[model samples]
Target: MTITIQQQFSINLNALLDEAGVPASGFGRSKHVATSMDVGVATAGKWLSGKQIPEYDRLERMKEWLGCSFDDLLGRTEARGGRIPARAENVLLNMVGTRSATRISICPDEPASIRSDGVYALPIEGDVMSPYVVDGDMVCFMPAMSAHTDGVYVIHVAERYIVRRVNLTTRGTVKLIAENARYEAEEVDLAEEVKRRNGVRIVGVVCARILVNR
Candidate 1:
């Protein structure tokens, strides 16, 4: 059966709080849920008990607290080749057109600056990148005209877009490395077809990942 965003959120929130070891007691539950969102403590209490659907503003606040993109938080699911929300697609498009310097950010506690300028909420479609990115992580990107010496990047091979690390050789050979030890890195010449295909585009280099960890 199809589930509404509220239902999905309630399920996910309960799961996250439980995993975080937050007790389901009245004060603990209210405080936990409220901290995750901007809702009032009383409202959170009501939400935890399913007394009512949260208002729109509260939901948006919850999205921010959970760090999931607006779409995923809204429980928009896709099966097979179904279309994703237009707004989500627009966010991806905007990321593509944004400038390079505007696309990167440093990760939490990392001295090195990370990329965040062009973050696309890609709905992962395959398990080729299992265990690292998982199936639902919204991978953000920073744009790069060429591969870095050693860093993960979004590369397009054929018409398929994949996320992998790029290892550039001094002689100009590029290797696509998958973090999952199961996948072997593919080495290719610098001027290969994958580098020039019309569909081959580097969405961006991963900057930071925001997932709902309760």
Candidate 2:
């Protein structure tokens, strides 16, 4: 049987949260999620029940907590000009007129800096890194650099780029952590030389994220 959007969302939401191991009774789930963004369990319960939709900001936080793609959480939506919609072009242009150049870079000027270099753009596809990085925000990447300074990065694994923080362990294992407390970090066995060989492949260091209040 075909599933309606609400049904699909409800199923996916519950499953994702469960997979993250934040069952309703545990304060760990609620505490971790609340650390990055302000949200309550009652509000989360309402969302999971499909009784209400979270505001854009909260939705972004939940996405990060679930550690999945935006499409994975929100269901698939049509792509906008090859990148998710961060802001209307008109609005960005107007903001650029007033803001400091160092603070924000207009989209039109993006290509000039990104096209030729190993750098590229990866729009954040989900909420796993919300508040700091949200769905639809553009994340810059540099494919040539494999080394990360123990922080968040855009990585291409299995042909898809995912954003997560990098943690180097004393045992020489690498852990990919989500910004949200709800999601557990994933560890991979890789030597420093192998990592430098571009086997895992670092897409780029995330400089900053651009989020619109929508």
Candidate 3:
């Protein structure tokens, strides 16, 4: 049977929240989301039931209260643009703006492990990292000069940037995995590809993500 946009949105929303690690009972008629977003319980319930889509302003606020992205909350598996901007330091940015790398500032509230020059802030255009990295969600990425124990990274290849999780296989090869299905995983043999011949390379490691308030 064909699904209406409302139905589809509902399905995607539930799945996305699940992926984001939201407990099913965390949001309900208890006025949790409604109170958090300053909306009515009926309005929040309607959203969960897919009876209505929250307005743009409410949607943005909901992301903050729930800690997700637009494409993520809506459950979109599309490809997002490459490269995002981050402060020169490891901190949480309250207002993340989309500007050239030269025009960003650094804050020192949230601390983490990252690099100096390796840290970059670029423009994110779409939902390639949807549910994980959404629109206006500029994140902090450190240059992945070497393999990390484990975590999502911004695989740098041919000057193009792709955000994904990477793994080092025992066969001396590296596996690249993306959060969205649109981008498939790539296995790069170190001894064969990088050592023997030049091939795709890792550019950056996504050590941190900064959620911007619209």
Candidate 4:
């Protein structure tokens, strides 16, 4: 069976803490750890319980505090392939041209940085998201079927695919925002949009960007 992220983190963290002279029972002494990371004890507890995974920033703090190396915490090191084109002849096409390949570096043992695994590389098709991303930029993202947090996401609307920053509003609507100020932001009722014509669909959340040809 594939080792789960929770299992991996729990085992590694417990081992690392033990090496650092902290027993399993010490996991609950989250106040000290949280204070070091500048977060709340509750958040630290969540990390210990594997209920929540920290981003790279917090992961760095954990590594430094525990005096553990990345491989020590992750259980392994080295780059792993992410995705490739299905066709054999078009393999080259998948890496360049109007359609290009996205090189991925994945480490499954990690619980932090969804950017670490399950990613997709999509090409930028327009200048709406310019300044941050322009045409020909390859965006690395995690596929998300719905919006739950504020972040950059690939959206499908009017039969066209576009990238935008999606934010949740108190009014129970989502705002599709463009980085280029010239383009105006659009708000939609997700439920209603699903029922209407030429509506909105969230493709994925952008995690990283690989820019090329400016």
Give the candidate number with the greatest TM-score: 4
Instruction: Give model 3's clash tally.
Output: 11
Residue-level lDDT of model 2, residues 1-214, one tens digit each, is 3434554455455435444433221223334445545767666544554445667777777787666776766673232223332332322222211323323332222222443234345667676764345576665443335543465576655545778878778877778877555578888765543445334645555543333432
How many residue pairs clash (N, CA or C atoms closer than 3 angstroms) in each of the candidate models, in the order given?
A: 8, 7, 11, 2
lDDT of 4: 0.58
Q: TM-score for every candidate vs. truth?
A: 0.42, 0.42, 0.44, 0.46
Off by over 4 Å in 2: 1-118, 191-199
- In order, the Cα lDDT scores of the candidates are 0.50, 0.50, 0.51, 0.58
Q: Which rank order by TM-score, best down to worst?
A: 4, 3, 2, 1
Candidate 1, residues 1-214: lDDT per residue as tens digits? 3444455455445433433444333225577777767668887866653345677787677666655555544443442133322222222332323354423332222212224333343444454543234455545555555665455566655655678767778877777776445579888775665447443444456533333221
What are the per-residue Cα lDDT tens digits for candidate 4 across 89-192? Answer: 22222221133335553322212333523556667877787545568656655656788866678776786668887879999999998866679999988888
Name the top lDDT candidate. 4
> Least lDDT summed over 10 consecutive residues: which range in candidate 1?
105-114
Please give the lDDT score for candidate 1. Answer: 0.50
| Model 1, position 9: C-alpha lDDT score | 53
- Kindly report the root-mean-square deviation of model 4 from the true structure over all alpha carbons: 15.7
Ranking by lDDT: 4, 3, 2, 1
- Among residues 3 or more apart in sequence or in different chains, the pairs in candidate 4 whose N, CA or C atoms overlap within 3 Å are 94-101, 95-101
Off by over 4 Å in 4: 1-118
